[model samples]
Target: MTVAAISWSAANARRMERQFLLNPAKPGQAGPGEVVDAMLAAHAQVMSAAELSVGLRMDGATRLDVRDALWGEEPSLVKTYGPRGTIHFLPVSELPMWTGALSAVPGGPSPFKAGDRLTPSQTDEIVGAIGEALDGACLTIDELSDEVVARTGPWAGDLVLPAFQGMWPRWRSVMHVAGHRGVLCFAPNRGRKVTYTRPSAAGSEEPPLSAEVAAGRLVRRFLYAYGPATSPEFAKWAAAPARWAGEVFASLASAGEIEAVEMEGVPSSWVVAGDTEFPAEPVRGVRLLPYFDAYVIASHPRERLFPGRAYERALAGGQAGNFPVLLVDGIVAGVWHQRRSGRRITVTVEPLGSLNAGQERELEGQAERVGEVLEGWAELVVGPVAVGAHA
Candidate 1:
């Protein structure tokens, strides 16, 4: 059977516009819950970056709006450790699905085979202890660790490990582990210390969605947002074992939930069965996407999005989010950085090639939008379009 095809241009436009990156922010246009639900979750390692991520999509959204949606009373959003075990801002009501899907993911064995590390059983105990400790209240990691020790014996706190910041206690590692159980999520910051809380409207009972069920839904959700991908791509995105991702893909393909399509030069492309409608209008306008933007990460097959020399300059060590990028139409055309001085946000765009009058105009407008989101004036500085400087 000949699989249907989705062009690079079409796919880019549909996802950019649908993901709301091509539009202006309209404050309160969509409820806080709806904004995140559309993208599944926003990359939120840095709270400010996450705020900018949401602001670009909505109309005139202020930082406080993002905060209210998150760490607010009657919040419409929830903070949780999502795909790849990275912190993300998830829609509040979707905790069950996120938890169910993530919980099923095999974390694999501890990297260190032996030593002062958490045994499998001990790790699980920490997860359970976290849920119980934070059942209806917020607690700092240190505060919660004490309760975990009380619940699971001293083994829960004895395991100390090295991390990006420094040595991470067993209690700290399990924070995301507890997140997978759907009972625990991050609470608002209390002064300088981070805290954990139970998700609003979350039940203490067992997760309603099973691992198998959640895995299938996760596949569909990924394809719905970034489709025409292979099983391996899904695995990379979810941080799941390859064998498991293949099983999920097979199950979905058998159920007719997704179908295969032959992309131009690529093989084994599949999209949601009925989500093949291409954008009626081609994507226009320029966009200055921040580091770790969802659009940059969601797309599969780096070569298509970054193209030839564009990839090297935009990515560092083949990793995304190392540098902010310039997007003309739908492909990465250059790299840019911003510096804020008082009320002025000066954006320096270093393109890979010369731009026409129209692209320059659109880029300035895009820069202005960024300034608006930051509540500052925008100044555009177009430097020479150069690449391969390191080479």
Candidate 2:
């Protein structure tokens, strides 16, 4: 059947969830850490560095183990590629193609465009100086800036700081491009320090794919990983231009990679892999999805994924800043937070609507799991903590 025919019924959503959310089995695995690493590489979202660490913990993976398995051997590879402008733990085989696609897309607005002004040439020099300083050493952004000022004479003192003040936007663009070129990659951070490394010779010599091809490949990957999505969803999630997003979907359709699907009540057309199909029932459990989790942040038209009234509360502040939420039966039922007092770790669940006994128990269980991954010895407490209603 064509994509337009298959509706994203509750069954379809659950099937996608099982494939991408639940950890895969690895029989006769070598190390616990390695097995966890593979699971994360395949499923976890690494779009934001902080999100990567948090997602692992939520998925029953520990911080130390994640670092040991994914970051221990080749520190540089971790930082090089992934979705959004962040570093995801992608399969080594998919690294080259993914990075190439992301780099071809033009970056979003730079925060530096506001007050801190620098000509394009000056910005180039600033980046060049930072790169030179980080030639062989892994330094934090602060350290890199310090080194740039120390070596660049007068430009380093005041001009560099202001010029570089709002530079993350610009630097991120360069990072995207350089990441595609296999020049720099994401590594573990020591506090605010940004640990980076040069890409391997093999990664460096690889040629980038054309923009159209890269976009198509990326869309396909997203569909396979987070399928039954729409062009707008793909566009928002990948940060690709709308026109490019449409083209990618069209190209995928041409290649038989995606088929259109219709939501029962929604009017817009959705796309999923040609082979994509969901089960007949929904998984009965509550899952604590971390902030900016792929499942939550994969698209802008999130109303389909969440209840209508609860949207404003979950996304309390605004679209750009959404609080961490609890997903019950593929719908956002409430928001959750962790409070640590001395040795006790208290997980407070604030449901937007009244929850039944089963849902409450499920939330408690999920909260306990979160506690286990975060603090090994801390006491776990799960229940409602009164908080003001959110808009």
TM-score per model over all chains: 0.91, 0.74
Cα-based lDDT at residue 242, candidate 1: 91
Candidate RMSDs in order: 3.1, 5.1
- What are the Cα lDDT values of the candidates? 0.77, 0.54
Show model 2 residue runs off by greater than 4 Å: 1-4, 11-60, 74-77, 80-91, 108-136, 146-177, 190-192, 201-210, 265-273, 299-301, 317-321, 377-391
Determine which window of 10 residues in candidate 2 has minimal summed lDDT.
34-43
Query: What is the C-alpha lDDT profile of model 1 across 211-310, one tens digit per residue?
Result: 8887888788888877777888888777889998888888888898988876666768778877778786778877887768777877867888888878
Number of backbone-clashing residue pairs for each candidate, in the order shown: 6, 7
lDDT tens string, model 2, 59-170? 4554454455446663322444455655555544455666577766766566453544455665566556655665666766566657666665554345322344452323
Cα deviation of 336 in candidate 1 (Å)?
Answer: 2.0
lDDT of model 2, residue 13: 57
Clashing pairs in 1: 25-58, 25-59, 25-60, 26-58, 26-59, 27-59
**How many steric overlaps does candidate 2 have?**
7
